[model samples]
Target: MSSSLAQKLETRAKSLGFDVVRFTNANLPELTGARLQAFVEAEWHGDMAWMPETLTRRKTPTAMWDGAVSAIVLATNYGPEVDPLERLTNKTTGNISVYALNRDYHDVVKGKLKQLAGWFASQSGQEVKV
Candidate 1:
């Protein structure tokens, strides 16, 4: 990706509430696949059965989609602005986790992702799989 395009994507992602945006080659390392296998074999994911089911595809982006050349990862902080530990001792009022108190982030994020994907396709003149 061009530096200018990367900057634009980063800026747009930030405007859409993404705290962190990064771009990486789609082909993941062998170590990643090995680690994922280890994680699944150890049964550390608990009730998330999808993790093991999708293990083969999750090992690498290319395994899931052959045409994918790059990956844009976005992350946001869902933690509360105030100290959550302080609320542990306060039994008078109910304390809710910051993420749980707000509207479902999935909806918000999906909308933003669509917007971002549209913008990216327009800018890069490339098809966005998502």
Candidate 2:
């Protein structure tokens, strides 16, 4: 069952031009989650309410949602031709986080996630009405 699902996922990913695909458990690592929760409790994430919500989810992804099978962490490298830090010297203008200066990544990455979800549903024979 796992082999066929993996094969189908790979094939669908290739068709959608994905570089790689992998599966993960819903439950995050215990030590990592505990440390994250501790960090949140310490108020290290000042002014970020999302951090607490993330901590709650990290405590256990499975508890957050039923039938949650995997978590996809995707990153794209927009290689800077020159030193991005050089721009910081000219403090006259605003210096956005290097990545946010450009296009919205959620738009770019969500399409890939949608494609993967489609393939997974199809391969698994699960009715993905969503």
> Which candidate gets the maximum lDDT versus the true structure?
1
Clash total of candidate 1 = 0
Highest TM-score against the true fold, candidate = 1
Candidate 2 has a TM-score of: 0.64
Kindly give the number of clashing pairs for every candidate: 0, 0
- Give the residue spans of candidate 2 off by over 4 A: 14-20, 67-75, 78-97, 127-130
As a TM-score, model 1 comes out at 0.86
Off by over 4 Å in 1: none
lDDT of candidates 1 onward, in order: 0.88, 0.70
List, residue by residue over 1-130, the lDDT tens digit for candidate 2.
4777777777776666556666566667889888888999999999998889777766877666767776544344554567889998997997778777766766656776687778777678764321
Q: For candidate 1, lDDT tens digit of each residue in 1-130? A: 8999999999998998889999888988899899999999999999999999999889987878888888999998766677888988988998787678777888877888999999999999988866
In terms of lDDT, the poorest run of 10 residues in model 1 is 76-85
Give me the displacement of residue 93 in model 2, in angstroms: 9.9
